[model samples]
Target: MIRVLLVDDQTLVRAGFRSILDGEADIQVVAEAANGADAVRLTRELRPDVVLMDIRMPEVDGLEATRQVCADPRLSGVKVVILTTFDLDDYVYGALRAGASGFLLKDTEPSEMINGVRVVARGDALLAPSVTRRLIADVVSRGRRPEPSPRLNVLTAREREIIAVVAEGLSNDEIAARLVLSPATVKTHVSRIMTKLDARDRAQLVVLSYESGVVTPGWLS
Candidate 1:
């Protein structure tokens, strides 16, 4: 079962998510928290596979909670998915940089939200193509320059190419079709790239791609 912890300041919001997610056979709503402090505490206790975190809270906001959770060596297997009211939430990028696997708009369709939980639970990023573009745009608008990492030197030419395509938000199948290779081949390349960069998942790979200068905002144009 994919265990999930729901963290939201609003009781109704947490109940809504629990109701939707509990109906899934593969998903279980293990616990709920009305604040970030409880969220982090419960997370350390339960160690759920996925955490649905709310950004704005009374004490210890989701961003800081996410930082605390992600930074914990014991919670490395846990994935945090930010729940926001807006698609381009100001806290989204910060949460991602702080080790959140992805963000889901609270108003997203029930089916999409369910699938998103499963995606992150299985160690995949919940970033869709449109979301990826908007995330990149947000970063660009912030006027942040590329802060390259020495880890880029470890990737091969083909791996670099794959990482760039991944930053474009293509799935393994799509990348395979574009590069005329099998899906398995593409998955392998992505895995290798993640290992080399020590990325937690595809989300971090995307962050690394931009932050490391392997992909720039101009590339999208």
Candidate 2:
């Protein structure tokens, strides 16, 4: 079973999500938090497999909470999927840098939201194609990606190409079609990219791809 923590400030939103998620046999909500502070505390206590975090909260806020949770050595396996209404570029980049596994719009369909939690639980990257584009924009808006670090140097040219496609919000199959490669080949490239970058998941890859200057903002379009 996949254990989850719901961390939205609004009672109604939290309740609605809980209802939809609880109906799933494979997912369970082990705890809930109304603010970032509670989220941090509950995260350590429950150690849920995934955290569906809200970006705007009264205390500490989701970004900081995600940072705290991700920084914890005890909860290294925990994954955070940030939930927000606005696709504000800053929040998207901040959450990823803070180590969120992925980001999802609050209005996301129940099925997609369910899949997101499960995906992160399995240790996969947190990006859905649409979300990747936003991350790319955020990286480019800051003027420079490819932070002066060797973290991204591990990727080969082919792997870099794959991440570029991903930043365009292409699905594995879409990437395959566009690149004139097989879906299996696209998947292989994505996997290799993840391995080389030490990216914990796709969400981080999306951030790094943009931040690391692997994909430019203009290239996203």
Candidate 3:
């Protein structure tokens, strides 16, 4: 089962998410926190597989909470899915940089939200294509890119291309079709790339791809 912790300051929002997620047989809402402090405490204590975190909260806020959670070795298995009210919310970018696995608009469909939980639980990246595009644009607008790092030289030419496409928000199947390779082969390359880059998952790979300049923010468009 995928254990999830719901963290939001609003009682109704938490209740709403719990109501939607509780219906999934494979997912369990293991805990709820009204703010970032409680979220951090419950995460260390319960160590759920996924955290549905609200970006804005009283006191600690989701970005700092996510940073703390990601920093804790004890909670390394935990993946945070930030919740935001706006698609273009600037806080979403910081949350991602803070090691959140992904973000979800608060108005996401119930089915999509459930699927998102399962995706992240299985250790896949979960940014929507549109969101990914917007996020890259926002980062570029702010003049941020990966600094010069020797870590990038580890990837082969093909692996570099694959990582760049991944930052473009394409799935393995889509990438395979674009590159004229089988999906399984694409998956293998992605796995290898993750290992070489020491990325937590594809999301981090995407982040590194941009930061390393293998993929630029303008290339995302």
Top TM-score hit: 1
Q: Tell me the whole-model lDDT of each prediction, alpha carbons only.
A: 0.87, 0.81, 0.85
lDDT tens readout by residue for model 2, 115-153: 888878986666765555655475567674355457757
Q: Which ten residues in a row have the lowest lDDT in candidate 1?
A: 132-141
lDDT of 3 by residue, 1-221 (tens): 99999999999999999999999899999999998999999999999999999978899999999999988888889999999876446787777777888888888899989999998998878865586667755675576555767897888889988988888777788899999999999999999999888787777887777677776576545
Backbone clashes for every candidate come to 0, 7, 1
In angstroms, give how far residue 20 of model 3 lies from its true place: 0.4
TM-score of predicted structure 3: 0.92
Candidate 3 runs further than 4 Å off = 144-148
Provide TM-scores for the models. Answer: 0.94, 0.83, 0.92
- Model 2 segments beyond 4 Å from truth? 129-132, 142-151, 171-189
Which residue pairs of candidate 1 clash? Answer: none
Instruction: Pick the lDDT winner.
Output: 1
Q: After superposition, how far is residue 166 of candidate 2 from its true place, in Å?
A: 3.2
RMSD in order of candidates: 1.6, 2.8, 1.8
